[model samples]
Target chain A: MIQHLIVLPVVLPLVMGVLLLLTRFGSTGLKRSASVITTLLVAVVALALLLRASNGEIAYYALGDWQPPFGIVLVVDRLSALMLMLTAVLALGSVIFACGGDDEKGSNFHGLFQFQLMGINGAFLTGDLFNLFVFFEVLLLASYALLLHGGGKSRIQSAVHYVVLNLAGSALFLIAVGVLYGATGTLNMADMAARLVELPAERDGLVTAGALLLLVVFGLKAAILPLYFWLPRAYAAAPAPVAALFAIMTKVGVYAILRVYSLIFGDNAGNLSALEQPWVWWMALGTLVAGTVGVLAARDLRLLVAYLVLVSAGTLLAGVGMGTPAATASLLYYLLHTTLVTGGLFLLADMIGQQRGKAGTRIVKGRPMTQGGALATLFFIGAAAVAGLPPLSGAIGKVLLLDAAEAGQRLWLWPILLISGLAAIIALSRAGSTLFWRSQDGDRGGAALPRPQWVGVGLLLATSPLLVALAGPVNDYTRATADQLDNPDAMVNALISGNGDTP
Target chain B: MESLYAITTGVLSACGLYLTLRGRTFPVVVGLTLLSYAVNLFLFSMGGLTTDGAVVLDGAGDYADPLPQALVLTAIVIGFAMTAFAVILAMRARGDMGNDHVDGRTREDSEESRR
Candidate 1:
């Protein structure tokens, strides 16, 4: 059974999604419990997968016994396993929060949410490029539905822009994949890496174009500077739970860039080695600047949180742009901190909005919350963590990335990243004070938030301190993951050997 | 023949992109459809375009590469679903916002200098 653990992340959610769809007319409680239990199970399994991966072994599960370089395979390295765990945890939180009543507002909420998980997990795990595209589409399919869930005029508007942009992105993804396949005659990433090492000079131009095109697709996913205009509006308008799930969605793109670039075009691939680093650096810095501006400019709490996602993306991309194992490790740590905290903040925003009556998540003077004290407390911790203040995960994540930067890169990275951190502090404190302290005028406070909602928010927000507490082990894991990623030969060999796993 | 195929894909993509940039959702949906069709054709040609080639038979002489065909099939299915969803969403957006404009702004709003 453990032998099948690799495929479990993809299959379990898929099966559960179908089950939820079949029982679409059943009690909402059934769907919620079933979905939460399955997500928790996947989380546990993801933990096991991470443990198996911790030992620095590259493993793969080939579907239908079709061997690598020929058939589709799901590869589980430290990075993919770590992502599976992150996605599962985030899904658990979002699903629970949805049960607070958002799920009831839309049809197939649980089902589509599960399918989204399946797509995210599948994207993280797949070794085949085409399979990755399939997962991207799968996740997009679920997201487009979930984005329009509990449809509002703003949602439909943002969904139109989001859907149109992503459709164009999908077309670009297919073209990139096709170009790469035509050039390399293989879609398996490790295989592609191996082939890239020996690829003829004549094919270099084709490969370069394909590789860069792939970067464009992943960049859109990562919401880098130019391509990120759609993110804040779409995220701000999404149902809070769906928006939280999207916290990991951007990380999916960052992971692809990390995986594809570091593995296929690493130091071994002669001319194409680190081809994307220069592009990524400039884009990352630009994105960082843009995010800082967005963070400070945001008026609504949800929109502010959404811009924080952009800030995190910029920081993570900068780490990737630095192009060192230390930078990769640092970025992975930051990825964990940002994804969870931002997700918690999205849920927190909803909670605050609930209590504000007409004020509704905007940073304005309004009625105080019924659960004012608890909400303020959560907001305080979340703000401190997200702003890169001391005694939390965000500060450590930032310090590690800064420490990892090379001298020449440091000149560019330090000021921008620090300023972005400062921007976050300003925006978050402003939003917090407005929501908590300034709202003394109106006497409207909704009923106390639900039990599940608190539990859900607690699950995600609690991870910040936990991340700080667990920093040692987590950093070690990320460093090892980076080391594993920096060297692609192990994966190539592992795939070539049909068993492709630990003995 | 290969040039013709490439030209067709290029023209379709150009038209699709132009239409996609239009302010209205209907044009945007139609543009996306054209774009997907172009992508489908491009994917089909990725396996080294063959006029008379068999993908199913094992070890057949002059056989077409089966992988690209399989890939194209997946892309087509996904594209179809996306187009269907986009079409429905466009209608819903029209109903909700009282405009088919992509940003849901009225024609007058776009034409007017200031609100």
Candidate 2:
């Protein structure tokens, strides 16, 4: 049963992706039904995994029944299970948005979308470093296909950069894994953590170098500073639903960083403390600067949203870098908020783009409040929430993160966070002022927004407030999850001391 | 023997970095390949080289670390796939844009949008 839970997320998507590919020959109804069913099934399975993990047990499933230090392991602890659940939810939302697109392109869209989810779920669940590489490949391959699904010139150009940069990162990841394996004598994460402590002091420098190399690999994936130039361009050029999906992909990289840093490196037994602290701070600060600048400099609505993602990622990492239990909890909460809000904003941008595309104008020329009234209202609400305005999930998470940072004596991050938040608000307002506030000159004809456009934005808007209203339960869960993440002794003991027999 | 491998690793890494910082895509790819080789060798040495080491463990005397070798094998395969994907994408980009530039058409897009 435990093994089934561990494999279900990836296997379901893998089988469904293949099945969806086969069913492409069938009717449109069949593809839609298959995709909707598959996504919902994944969501349910992820929820079940989260519930199981909340019971304070770390479930490990070893491939081929091989013991530790030999077999690849799939771990479903509170942290990973939560990320899986979030991925499933965002995936479901993105699929729905995809379905709402022009039906002629639905089949190919759904197929590639499911493949991307397979990669994400696989990345979240894999327990060994090498297997994580395979999962990253799976995700990137799907992204390449999906980014080009719309087949526009801009999309293709962006996809090229996206593919090239990620391939470079993947090569570095491979080298890092090779070096790590050489030093530790094992690929199993738990085993690596155990062995890292016993390595000679002279080897510590080598180990830290290898770890930093992996950091660069994950950083590129996460869109941290210096390696993030590719993200906004690539994401902005892709179709809206695809961009929303890409939003979650970067977080998957951050999730890997968080998981590996805390569980394998930051474990009390390791010498990573000397290295992890300063590295985290520098990266986090750099991320904040990059994100803030990216958001402020964007002119396009989609590009603005993409840059805001960078900002939120930076803010979340700042919290994580603080490395306190409270900060980690705040980081987890912020992760959830940022994923949802960014995803919602991207979906809204898609709806706006579709409206603009249909209207044959660069500017929306109408009384948006009256013409696209409901959508305009919902868009503002969602955008405001994302900008960390009060009475939303984003605000709740920001407050917690700020508190945690202050408590950790990283108060200087507070100003950067505040400025970024202000910049996000300014950018959102600028885009909104152009998009929703301004009336078109009489020469330009304003078109009516479609009802389908409202549906996607409306769904996201409705979901954003729940993150705030449910903050109590969400915060508690995130806090408990962070506590477990910060101290993985229980997890390590379970994996090492499990019934002493191969499955 | 260890010192020789270290020197080789340093030289390969330097060459890889030099190539990486080049402006052209082809040279960057070459740099990446060289860097990967250096990385693999460096990782292999972490298991500590033994002249008469065997990979198999049938009571073999002083079997070299199989772990790093196993990891390097995966890395090599993945690295090859990465290089293939990158080269294909580069080909596609050049075919599309009629140039081998890495920055894509951002300048063109900005100028066109302005016009």
Candidate 3:
């Protein structure tokens, strides 16, 4: 059973999505039960895969029982499994939070949600580049529908921009894939790595151009600088649950970069290592600065969280470009920490919006709430965690990141990271004070929210301490994952001949 | 023959880029569609544009690589879906927001913000 668990993460959601669509007009209870059951199943399978990978094992599954480099193969190493586990955890929490109130916004929400998971999980699992593109489209298509699920004017407006921009990105992706296949004649990543080693120097320019085009596409998706303007608006305008689920979307772009760069282009002798792309670091710096500035300037809570997403992406990408094992390890850790914190923060922001009448999460004075005390406490915990205050997982992740950056002799990254963190603290404090501390114009309070909503937000918030408690093992796993990424020979060998021992 | 395909791809891509930069949403969708068409053509030619080549298995004569064909087929389907979604979104935006500006704001909103 465990041996066959690699495909379950994607297959379960796809099956559930079809079932939910068939019963779209059924009772809410049925849809909710089916969705939760499917999500739990996926989470269990993802955890099983994670455990299998943790013991230094790679699980490879070829669909239709065909051999790899010819068939569509699903490869599960520590890094992909780690990403899968994080995404499952976040997806489950978001679904629970959505059931609180957001699910009523549109028909077929559950179905679309499941389809979105299928896309994300498929992207994480696939070993071939073209399948990655297909899964990317699947996820984006689902996200487009989910973003508009509520059917609001603002949502539709933002969806237009998001759709157009990503369509362009997809077009570029196709061109890149064409160029790469034309030059190398293979779309399998591991096979590409092996082929790249023998690629003649004269053909280097074509491959390099293709690789950089891919970087731009991933950069746009990851919300890197100058390519990130579409994010804040789209994320801010999205419903809370959708935005929460989207916390993992940018990381998908980052994951693609990490996987492809580490596996296909991490060749020191092949002249394709990402270290040759110096602009990544500088762009990361700009992104960090831009995100921090956006955080400071944002007038609404959700938009602030969206900008913070950029901040996290920048930090992780910077760590990626640092190209050291320790840096990569810290990046993997930070990636999980921020994904949970950001998702939780978005849910909290929604709860706060409902509590404050007329203000709706905007940093302004509004009517006082009857549940002000509890909501304020929840907001403080989430905000403090995201702002990297002491005694939280965010703070620990920051320390690890800074330590790794320092070891990499990227001293300049220190000021940018620390200063951006400081700016975030200021921004969060200002927003928190305005939303919680400022008195209401009128004393007409809104209705109290459901218990499950509080529990959902609390559940996500609780992971902070849990991560801190399990910091040792988690850090070890990430370090091993990073090491595996740094040296892809074992992974390549496993896929090539299916006999190599994993790291 | 190769030059014709290349020229067509370039011309379509240039037009697509121009349309994509427009402030309105409809033109942007059209731009993306044209761009996708160009990309599909480019991808199809990646297998070396073989004429009179067999696509079936066990062909003895010269054969074009079939992988790109399969890939472009998938790309075309996805591109069509994306274009359809974009057009629907544009129509929805125009209906709900009363305008189809990419930002969902009108001329006055920008001017006021500038102030």
Candidate 4:
């Protein structure tokens, strides 16, 4: 039963996505119904997966019942399970938000959405490097379609750059994977980790080069540093729901980095002793600088939200770079907060854009915040949560990460973090104050916004406190997950011990 | 023989990088393709060069690292798809924006205009 639940999140979307494609000519009601059902099922299965993971790591299936190194594996350990849940939650929220809109541009929207979810969940769960690449392509293809769904000129222009940059990254990723397989003679991640240990020290340099290539690939996907120029333009131009979903996509890249680096490369045990600290530290610094500068440079609200996504990426990378149990826990915590808050902000951007039309520049106007009454209030709360105000989930996660960073004696990391936080607060608060407190523009009538939309905002705003309250449980779970991530030996032993089938 | 392959990969990478930094979309696409080739070659070389190593497991004295070859084969297919997609997207952007430069705005003064 537990194993069945492990595959449910990935399988459900996949089957539904294909089914949706077959029923492309179906009625709008049917398509919407199918989308809702699929999303809800995914949510339920993901919850179950999380519950099962609480017990410990679970290697749900070996492909064709073949054993390690021989067949593909899909493991649902604590990290993958948590990510699965986050993906499903965000997908559910985005789909609901999509339905709220007036337009139904095409019948294929729900299908493509589900397909993208399938890719994300598959990427998270797969234990093979080759399979990871395949799933990434799956997600990319679906995203290409969704990004251009509305087929606007600006959207297409941005999507072009987006596709090209990611394609370059994908090519680099493939090369890296090819090199790794050649060196270790296996694609299964755990098997590769084990094999890499026995190789000569010179071979370690080759492996490091390949790992760096893979890191660059994942970095582009995660919107790190120089490669991140493509993100703000592309994400800001995407449709609101699509933009919301793209929030999770970067997290997928971060997840891959965490998994591959920590499991396969970071713990090589023999050849890694010399270079580990300085290398990751520099990478973390690059991420921090790129993200803070990106956020501070933004002018529009949607662009501001996009840039904040970069900031979160920087912080997460820094946390990972610290490379301690506490640091990893903080990274995981921050990741959770960042995903929800960023998704919520993107949705809020859509709502604000719709209400104020294209003329809505900053959330703040000249003297005061704009008034949508309760809707404005809800938006403010969401924005505040994103800026890491006290009592919010973001603040709690930031404190955890800061504690870990300080303990690691990464004193230089502190100022960058403070600057990033301040920049986020300024950008978000300016937007919040302008949107909620200022009077409406004189040209526009002071008409009241609808209640249902405010209800959506309220729902998101309500999650902030709940996440904050659950911070203790969330931290405990993350710490345990981090332990498994940092040391996969026991998990690998269990798998190899079970079937002994090497592919 | 290994050194020759290494040099070829280096030159290809340089060419790719130069083209990638060009202002036009077409050059970037071409550059990316060239870069992919260089990358693939470098990855293949990592397994060490064998004269006639076949990936298929025949009575096999020593296979030239069949695993890298298998991985590279998939990568080639995926790379072609990505390049095709990117080129098509570039053409579409040209049609939509009426300009083929990577950035939608020209070299001079657009930021000021937006401000």
Q: Whose DockQ is greatest here? A: 1
Candidate 4 CAPRI classification by DockQ: medium
lDDT of 1 at A338: 97
Name the candidate, 1 or 3, with the larger TM-score value: 1
Model 1 ranges with Cα > 4 A deviation: A23-25, A442-444, B56-60, B113-115
Please write out the lDDT profile of model 1 over residues B33-111, one tens digit for every residue. 9999999999999989888787667685888888888999999999999999999999999998888989899779877
Better of 1 and 2 by lDDT: 1
Question: What tens digits encode model 1's per-residue C-alpha lDDT throughout A155-176?
Answer: 9999999999999999999999
True contacts kept of each: 0.93, 0.43, 0.96, 0.59
Candidate 3 residue lDDT tens string, A58-165: 778888877777888899999999999998999989898888868877888999999999999999999999999999999999999999988888788778878888
TM-score of the A chain in model 2:
0.94
Q: Give me the candidate number with maximum TM-score.
A: 1
Cα lDDT listed for each candidate: 0.92, 0.77, 0.88, 0.77
lDDT of 1: 0.92
TM-score for each candidate, following the candidate numbering: 0.98, 0.91, 0.97, 0.90
Residue pairs in steric clash, candidate 3? none
The order by descending TM-score is 1, 3, 2, 4
Clashing residue pairs for model 1: none
RMSD of each: 1.3, 3.3, 1.9, 3.3
lDDT of 3 at A210: 91
